[model samples]
Each structure stands twice: as structure tokens, then as C-alpha cells.
Target: MGIGDAQVSAEDLETVTQQLGRTPRGTRAIASRCPSGHPNVVQTDPRLPDGTPFPTLYYLTCPKLNSLVSTLESGGLMKEQTERLATDEELAAAYLRAHESYLAERDAIESLGTQVTAGGMPGRVKCLHVHVAHALAKGPGVNPMGDEALALLKAQELWPAGDCAETAAG
Candidate 1:
């Protein structure tokens, strides 16, 4: 995802803290917001302030989104997507590009010196959360599988609506 302005206010941090139920570390900016104007995807620093490596550059922080993704996982969407990847040459190429793009974005902040990208990218579909976060933050067309999952969510009428993230703050 594009980093955008990379601005994180104290209020924004507070909202994220509430959403995650913990202090967020190395939060670079709010990469994407839900339609209700709350952060859903956050752009994070590749490495934590304490020098611990954090490979996840874009984090999905909305509790509702998390719950929906978890449900999707339990429904075996990952396996379906992975199976499609094996046979869909166009999709496989896009997924590989997504992997490379993820690595490049993280490297721009700080080189982790590892090819490992989130959500079992490049060859496998592992975590819908990562892919969803990527698609949400970066928008459609960047990650093929992510786009597919998002389309599924839309079809199921499960796309997060309302200020669910703000509700966590309450």
C-alpha cells in the first residue's frame, strides 16, 4: 500500500490501541480507513523501536474485519484460493508480483534482508488477514487473491460498515 502522509496523531494511536487492545508499536500511519472514518489498515514500520523485526508492514486493525476474516478462514477460502493459484497462471503471476511489491515496500522502510512476505505469499495463500489488509490499504489490482477475498466479502454482504473500530474505543 502507498504510505500516504504517514501521519499518526495521538488520537489515532488511541483509537488503534483500543482496536488492538494493546499499545501499537512502530505504527507509521493509518494506511486505510473504514467507510466510517476509522482506521482499518495501518502502515507499520518494518522494525520495532526495540530493534525487533516486524515483517508485517500493513496491519488490519478493525476488530470487525478481523472477525469476518477469521470466519472466511474457517470456511476454507484459503484452500480454495491456494488451489486456484496453482492452476491460474495469470493469478499466480499477480500473486508473485504482490509478494515482490510487499518486500519492496518493507525494504523501503528498512531492509529485513529476507524474502519472506506475509500471508504465505509468492506461492501460497496462508492468511486472509494479511491479504485483506494489503488489498484494503493498497486498493484493488495490487493483490489478486486479496481482491478475490474482498469480492467474496462483498458478495456475502460482509464488508465492514459503520464505525466498528470506534466502538472498540467505547
Candidate 2:
């Protein structure tokens, strides 16, 4: 199927949740953190006291080539193919790019940190680095684009240990 045509299904989401040992509610909760360590559940589009948007982790779920790769790798479809698919180089590169973008966004937010707020709550935004890492560490059920997205998310944070590369290599 063409890249854009692939879709992430409910089954895929269930698989990811099972693999990660996390519930959807937990995932959403993690996404709502502010820099000051306050949870943003009470505020819609909450900002930090310094005027930064609550740090958010975004994930675009879909089925695509990477999902195929993950399936093949999980099933031991081919030695050569698995080796190429499981390597760290490509993932590392993606992680770096994502990290750069996150840093830039953080800097921009910091510049406007004094103006962010929602209703009466003080803004406390911070980048959601771990969520991105989790996305990057997606296993066999996740599609290729999803994998790339995850890698970008992880790379943004200097390749955090215990996920993505670690799981893939293991």
C-alpha cells in the first residue's frame, strides 16, 4: 500500500499498549506534564508561568512499511533483512533530528516563558522527552513511519536507554 494509505488500527494500538505495559489513560496523563512538574489535566492548552505551552508529546500512529519490518523482524523472516532493520544507525540519526527540533522549540518557548497562562493557572511547560522515546521504541506492530517518528522522538533526547535501540537490539 502507498505510505499515506496505511492506517494504525485498534488492534495495533492494543498491541502497543500491551508491549509497553501502559494503558491509554497512563499515556495521556504523561503527555500532560508542565515544566514545573504539575500535571496539566486541569487546564486546556495550559502554559507555564513563563508563558510556554504545556510540553506535549505527539504521536502519529499508522500502519505502513515499518510495521511490515517489525512483523518480519519479530517472526525472524530473513536474517539479512532483520539485521538491517534492527540496526541502531538509522534510529540514532532520527533521534538526533528529533532532539534538535525539540530543543529549538523549547528555546522559543523559553523566550516567551513569561507570557503563557490558561485561565488562572500558572503555566509550567516542559518538553515531553520520554513519550517521544516510547514512540521510537515501538516494536513489531508499529509501522515504519511510526518507527521513524519514534526514533526522532528518542534521538531528540540523546537516545535514552532501555527502549528503542535497546529493545530492537535485544
Model-by-model lDDT, in order?
A: 0.87, 0.33
Name the candidate that leads on TM-score: 1
For 38-105, candidate 2 gives per-residue lDDT tens digits of 22111112244445455433332222323433443454433332244346566435544444443444
**Count of clashing residue pairs in every prediction:** 0, 18
lDDT of 2 at 53: 55
Model 1, position 162, has a per-residue lDDT of 48
**89-131: candidate 1 lDDT, tens digit per residue:** 9989999999999999889889999999899998888999999
In candidate 2, stretches whose alpha carbon ends up further than 4 angstroms from where it belongs are 1-47, 50-87, 111-170
